[model samples]
Target: MPDFLIVHTVLVTGAEGQLGRQVIRKSADQEVEVVGLSRLDLDITDLAAVRKRIAEPVTVINCAAYTAVDRAETDADAAYSINETGAANLARACAEVGARLIHVSTDYVFSGTSERPYEPDDPTGPKTVYGASKLAGERAIAELAPTSTIVRTAWVYTGVGTDFVATMRRLEAERDVVRVVTDQVGSPTYAADLADGLLELAELAEAPLILHATNDGATSWYEFARAIFAEIGADPDRVQPTTSAEFVRPAPRPAYSVLSSRAWGAVGLTPLRGWREALHASLAG
Candidate 1:
């Protein structure tokens, strides 16, 4: 790694988010200094605020995003403001201060029609406002900060947040049975694992401009729910599998949003552990 890649300070935006919190926690043992800023401290949509906050030569990991998938259908403007314009603001600020950016993205950029895992350079056909806004963010960062690394991950969950694992655990306690969508398939990435992968990329002198980082294997939401129940010593039999048609939401979900990890592997970093193993670790923590 080049001397420049030897990070001195890391500025993490969206510091209160699931992945952002993990990044902060994981970086404690590292030699570099880390500063985490929540939306209350720094709004990425405000260019002046972003510029003022990122005035130093530090690595900027943008975990901030408008993540309301279903609400984005009715609130496209709000989503675009944060996901697209906010990303552009950060990119521009990083370029001015000579800070490398690691922008977190989503797998929703793809249509999910591919039989195989989606690659970094695959054509994007976002099916929802949320997906389109996220894709716009990726484009803005790429165009404004050419040296930035864009990491696209999917099905991310953390123990602390209102994620899939938490939701399933709550429903299991309240209901007799839980119905999960079986038609949709994707890799479940623990926020902690994803955070570690982003930091690993931060340490590299050279990495792919675009990479897919997630847990090794893929599974449907139904399988994931069952695994979650098994992890908590609950009745896995209480988890029921159902198709997407049974419970429709405003935003269209991709049927297959699994992303390939070949790009991350090519950069000499191992992919994350399988979803089941990560889930167990997350629950145990």
Candidate 2:
């Protein structure tokens, strides 16, 4: 709790992404200075480049990733380069600089077979290349830089970025009925809330070994879409709940990968709100 708050520099990768940009906006209330970068500024897969970027002692929050779930089947090398290799590079550099590394990850690391929420210590059995790659990144960080905080979130959305919420909003304007997979269940995390949680964790003197940073309650994509429709004052009946088999993609998604924030709570961090409540706030914004 020392005054490390005085003009501390924060380096956020994938600044143009939904989560990164939210971190930028939310950090306005803090005393720390924030510098954000997209792939153009730093391709994290390059170890030398990452080392150079970490020359200054600053908090590094890596939000960069190849998130094309379906495309990952055909382009796994590219995904691994960005997700796995890039994470390794960043973790090594953070260790060199003694900086806290906050790496954003996904719930896809699990096989989605759990009846309850996955804990931080839960064994990861990824079903797709994208999931496997992200899980690899988590493992790399844990083995290489145990001081780093690996945040595994799920179904993230923001008003400005390309996410399910934005897609649903756009589709609602054109289609009378929209079908979403109901069997695949996870929490719909608001990027802004996740950003806040990261900043809080970053400023802390000690970061957790691992944490689940999603919104509290869980729901399938179908129920999530229905909630979105209702929040926007659209007809909930227009949102149809379907199974995953009907909407098959190139990558196999998890049937259920909701993550629990028990690890984060162990360190006394405030948990995020429930999905519906957070979604309402995002839509309003």
Candidate 3:
């Protein structure tokens, strides 16, 4: 609740997702109004519904995305519906109502072959349908709502549902040994931490059109899984390191996905805590 940033009513488009729910919970103590609508309540793919629902001047955080990576390879249409067209609908609606649009995107926008963290303005070349669709959404928003904010994050999980953290926790309880991908590297972002950051971004009046926000550091999936095992009182060695080639999927995962938070800090926003510390907090909670 800073004096510089003024917020009244903020609308969330994907309330049922873990990130959306976390943002709503975090907003309780902040000096802003956050209203959420799940897909059941308002499907963003429906332009008529988008216009009908969003008529006031408010800050809108879009969290709805087609996230099924492997499935998206075969279901590109479905992916485009939610990721690209749906985002376009919201952009048009926000522009018409003079509302601020803060769209949540993915680091998958990049090909993941870079040696360092991807900057906000880095050239993008997505490797999967899911990634391509999200990138398309980013472009659509840029064209429709030129001033809208697009924040790209990576490897986000809430230690629930089917996210990587949740899967690791379940495997630790069910099996003796688990093999995680070491060749693939990225920032493991806890959804709660990201939720807090988004709420902070919603309050800021002046921010870059595109920004990258994730945990401070980066690690491979195998290392991240080992860390998760250690946090939950399990043996870290039980998790074995492997490469992406050993475990191929229908859609290729980015070999590297660390997103740079330098842009986020340059804007005078609070830097998110480091990944290991944030992971401990998430498991402890």
Best-to-worst ranking by lDDT: 1, 3, 2
lDDT of each: 0.92, 0.90, 0.91
Per-model clash counts, in order, read 0, 0, 0
Q: Which has the better lDDT: candidate 1, or candidate 3?
A: 1
TM-scores vs. true structure, each candidate = 0.96, 0.96, 0.97
Error of 1 at 54 (Å): 1.6
Per residue, candidate 1 scores C-alpha lDDT tens digits across 183-275 of 999999999999988888888876777999999999999999999999999989999989999989999899998999998998888789999
Candidate 2 Cα outliers beyond 4 Å, as residue runs: 1-5
lDDT of 2 by residue, 1-285 (tens): 786546889999988888889999999998889999888899899899889989867999999999999999999999999999999999999998887799999999988999999998888899999999999999899988899989999988895546899888988999999999889889989999999999998888886778899999899889999988999999989998788898888898898979998888778889999888999999998
Winner on lDDT (2 vs 3): 3
Clashing pairs in 2: none
